[model samples]
Target: MKIVFYGVITAIALSCNVQAAAIDFSTAWYQVAQKNDALQAKKEEVKYSQALQDAAKSLYLPNVDITGSYTHFDKPISVDTPPVGNFIPSFNVPLTNQNFAHSSLNAVLPVYTGGRITAAQDIRQAQVDEAQSNYNLATRATFTQLVQYYFGVVLAEQVYQVRLDAVDALADHLNHAVKFEQQGQIAKVERLMAQVSLDKAQIEAQKSLRDYEIAKLALTKMLKQQDSVLPTTPLFVNNSVTSVTPYLTKTLTDHPGIAILNAKREQAKGMVDMASAKHLPEVMLYGNYNLYSDDSATGELLPEWMVGVGVRIPIIERSGTSQEVVAAKSSVRQVNLLQMQMQQDLSILVEKTYAEMSQALEEYNSLASSQALSEETVVLRQKAFSQGLSTSLEVADSQLYATSIRVQRLSASYNYVKSLAQLLSVSGDIDHFMDYLQINGIEVK
Candidate 1:
């Protein structure tokens, strides 16, 4: 029976190892970039902005229209002339017919609009800029999320391995206790205590397995993969200390959020220009050609074709163009203030994340000696128990202590990795994260 149980366990482990597909961080990010809906939406927004820009540019083109109309009068009007009674008779001259039909083709080309068109084009360009920045921001955000999920799986797997080791160690101790009690060398209570500790370890191992499965599921779903994913990148930490100054400077200069705000401010300025243009005159070149005329008089009165330059000066507007200008200026000020606040908030966030990364690294380093010591103690206690020099409880306690240290160290590494991702994301330097990983990352053993 014991052989059958051990065989089943080995088979299950082998199957799991075969089924999970190991992927590196870069490949995982590429998969996510291709599959993530939110990132695709942002890309579409950029295209939409580009279309708007084209539309704005089209405003410079002339507008052509064809119009036709028919009209009926109450009566035909004419003129009568009376001549000398004796010499000639009176005659009537026709002026117009009772019905008239006419058609015209017209074109209007803007010569100048007091900068209204220019302002509109500028605003549209700013919108394009803002859309591009937003897309970049979305990309960075997705990358950061991927980092968390990928490392989460690694950490869970490591923890589960530690739990399995603890279970194996306690099981050996329990077997020894059972044998000593049966040989009349130890009390039966000692055997029972060992059984309890082994049961507890088994329960913990089961919990860790559940956690590992959950983490794997999350990563698989993120990459839109049907098969289970195993992260090739381990949880890591850099022992070297990094300064926050460079991160802060880079964040202030290159952050997408800052770029978005700058775009908005420019858009607001464009609005102000557009509003002020309302108080100025517009110049246009207009032409009309008579396409058709049923009546000869109408054709003679309306010229065959006419062209003229037209000017429209705004004398009065009920909507108050001045108030519009004021509102637009106020918007510019508002955007400026928002930009300042965003910079401040981003700086603070960078500092906080940097500090957390440093702390996790320090904690991980500090636990190294403790982990070694605990591991050595576990081996010593197990040997002493086998020689009848130490109790089973002491061996179980040492095993549990070693397991706790391993879990804590793994947790610290995970924290460091997560914080580093966040710091890079906020600083607009997430693109360099893989470089850092390659240069500084020390994989947890």
Candidate 2:
């Protein structure tokens, strides 16, 4: 029985097909719709924000404008004149021109803007950095989804293989049943039972294929690919599992979820700065060069210019900049509170996933041992039946046990790998997944 069990194990190992080219997870991850859109939109937002920052920086630079106007008056103003050479009575005379035109070139350079320019630039800069954090969050979110779907396909493929093995084993049993019936060793009813089991196994294999196809199609859609992908990564548990202490310590600074929130908090703080800037007055230096045609008083064309300083003092702000400052401060407090809640939730999620990972690892290890025993039992029962020392029902029961254990082992393996990956994902350290596998000396094809 032991020899037969070893031979079966060898056969199963030898039957494994050469693995396909592995899908580059990094490449595939970039293709998912949510991540792609978030990344692209963030880039556009950065451009927009940079433009705003540039505009803010230009506040110190001078602004120049050109203006022109024409006017025709029905009655022109009269100029009061005194007698020049003689002691004549003072008189008034209407200006000859009734048409007038003026053109001007004006420029202003801000000396100060109540610190609004600086605050606005700071706000825009913070927003750009915040956009980058948002992109990182999107990446991590999409990666988490990929981990599930990616492993799902692998599990479905394993199930399909199990079903195929069961069907093949049942077909061989049906052949043996026919031979025994013809030789008068087994009843015709026994042969009918073998045929029935084979039919059921075939149906189950077909169903397993359907499930595999569905998983494959779902993965294809996520990748935005024209063809289905075959995952080359094997499912296996890390025997050298480590503690989650480092992850929790780093979560606040490194976790993409937390990073996004922190960035928002900084932006809100800048909002307070922007709102408070309105309390101070604005000052600017301005110059205007003017040309006039046919002035009513002088009846002469001339050009004139003025350069001066301007100030807009704030006396009463009816819109209440104070309220805006208060609101901005409240937003900071609210985001900080949300950040606290998220921290708590993340810690809980890590602990729960770690616990699940440990359980899956235990189940996986236990099943590995149970599978060998189940295979040995099936072989011994089959050998007994071949020697006429056991009934067909006894051999069939052994085969059923073997098949059940095989499926369970597959499930355990998948669960262990999936949970371990999930733990890293939630901790915002999925990049360390390969390191975890390496620690356990597991190789992925």
Candidate 3:
């Protein structure tokens, strides 16, 4: 633990003034979010549950205890004038016992616990399963959020780059317009229109740059660092062959939320059995050995050993036992209802996120084509303007359309990757998602 803490501290020192370092989806999801403080706390929770499971095993083992006592009498204990004294008249019978002490060691082995031990073991196992499920849930949720912030920052950067490109393109157009107007080939109004377009592009570029900064700051927080996030991976998708059907079953079986509900249901069932077990009997086997010391005129037995069996049964209870049994069974019923509800909710989430991903990918493909066409249009129009075959308005309009389509294209690409991440998380398979990235040449290091 100390090593991990110091490692993060050292990384923080290096990152504070570090240059832009490339970070990938797998690195951020596995290294940063997986080691976040909250997720680490859940890891501790799993350990605690394991410890309880170990404790439950001791219920079947024997326990040993040591006890000692001392007693003092001012006068001493005397034997009453007895027949032994009369029979031994020749010998004087004295009675004075004082300063007595005894030390004993006792051990008890449970022979039967009325099914309590079995129930306890079941409950502990369920607890361990629940903790594991919770840890899994934490892992998925952390990765989900990190994916959003990671790609969000990248998307912002992309948008800013596009805006920057537009500003530069518009600046060139403005310069050409000025030269044409000064040469008396174009009117002053055309030059003014070019200036207006460049001004607007510059203003929007500034806003995009600020937005990009904000997104990077958000990613930094998610990474729990003082440095900026530099997403090295590009926003791309080639998961056409990957469909949503294969994952539905795996999601139902492996998703942590459903696992949690199932664990709770089992725990409730254990409680019910434990409550019923309270009405049965318990038995134990015990052994004791003792050492005694006494100063007495009448000697006593000094050391002794004893072994015995014990049993306990609850003879009667008014409504306590029955009421507990009733409540525990009802709790089982409640958990069952919750399990059903959770399964339905999980299915809905899976299907909905899958559809969103498909739609975003489709939108990205369409906008990408539009952006290509718009880029070609801008180039041809600018060439025409240079040759005196087109006006500055035509060139400026083409540039504006190009920028708009590029912005939309970047947005759609971000949504596609973001929704794909969501789908992977909903299906509880971020590792597979990482694999998909690698398969598509989006290296994660």
Candidate 4:
């Protein structure tokens, strides 16, 4: 019966290993980039902004249109001349027919718009820049999330393996205790105590398994994968200490949030220019060609074609152009202040994340010696227990202590990984995260 139970467990493990799709960090990032809806939405927004920019450029081109109209008068338009002392009979001269139809092709080209066109173009360009920055920000956020879920799975798997090992060790100890009790070499209480520890270890193993499954599910969902993912990248830590100065510098210089604010400031400046332009005169070149005229009188009255330059000067305006300029200037100030605040916030975030990463690294390094000693103690206690020189409780405690140290070390490594991702994310250096991994990472054993 025991053999069958072990066989079933082995089969299930093998099946899971076969069904799971192994993915490396680069592959996972690529999948997320291709499949994430939010990232795609941001990309579409960039395209939309670009289209608007193109439309703004068209303002520099001439606008042409064809117009046609038909009108009916109450009666035929005519003029009658009275006879001069009956020497000449009265005569009627027709000015136009009762119905008239006319059609024309008209064109207007902007010679100058008091800089309104240029200002509009500048505003649109700034909007494009802002949209691009937003997309970049979304990309960074998505990649950071991927790092968390991807490494989270690795950490959970390592923990579950440690738990399984603990359960296996306790089962061996329990088997030994049972034999010793049957041989009258140990008390029955010792055997019962070993049984209880094994039971608890098994329960802990089940909990670890559940955690692993949850972590895997999160990663799979992020990548939009139908199959379970087996992360090939192990959780890693850097032994060398890193300074936070570079990260702070990068954050202040290259962060997307800062870029967004700068674009907004440019947009506000353009708005100010546009509002000021409204107070100046506009110049345009316009031309029209008569396409058709149904009445001969109308055709004779209207010119066949005409071309002229036109100017529109604003003598008195009540459209609040001054107020608009003031509002735009205020917006500029607001954006500048926001940029400053974002810089300060990002710097603080970088510092905090760096400290946390360093702390986790330090903690992991500090536990190395303790982990070694715990393992050694576990071996010694187990040997003594088998020889009737130590109690089952002592052996169980040593085993549990070793397992605890291992789990703690794994947790510390996981924390370090997450913190590193966050630090890079804030610093706008997340694109080079893989390079850092290659340079400083040590894979967990």
Best by lDDT: 4
Please, what is the whole-model Cα lDDT of each candidate in the order they appear?
Answer: 0.88, 0.73, 0.78, 0.89
Model 1 lowest lDDT segment of ten: 1-10
Please provide TM-scores, in order, for all candidate models, with all chains considered together.
0.93, 0.85, 0.86, 0.95
* Number of the candidate with higher TM-score, 3 or 4: 4
Query: Which wins on lDDT, candidate 1 or candidate 2?
Result: 1
lDDT tens digits, residues 1-445, model 2? 2234335533543343233235745456646744456567866776877787777777678999998877777866678888777768779887645776767899999898876777777777777677766666666667777867877888787777777677667667777878889999978887787777766666666676777778877887777666567776666667787787876776655776777677778778878887887888889999988754455544353447889999998888898899999999999999999999999998888888778888877876787678888889878877776677777777676777777887777777767777777777667777777666556545422
Q: Residue 421 error for model 2, in Å?
A: 3.2
Off by over 4 Å in 2: 1-38, 82-86, 93-96, 291-303, 389-391, 443-445
Better of 2 and 3 by lDDT: 3
Position 56, candidate 3: lDDT = 97
- Across 1-445, the per-residue lDDT of candidate 1 in tens digits comes to 2234334444554565577899999899989999899999999999999999999998989999999988888987677879868798788867678887889999999999999999999999999999999999999999899998999999988898888778777877887898899899888988988988878877787777778888989999999988898889777787764699988999999999999999999999999999999999999999999898876565568889999999999999998899999999999999999999998999889999999999999999999999999999998998888888898889888999999999999999999989999898888777677776678668796
Candidate 4 deviant stretches above 4 angstroms: 1-11, 81-90
Clashes of each: 0, 0, 0, 0
Clashing pairs in 1: none
* Per-model RMSD to reference: 2.3, 5.3, 7.6, 2.0
Candidate 3 lDDT (Cα, 0 to 1): 0.78
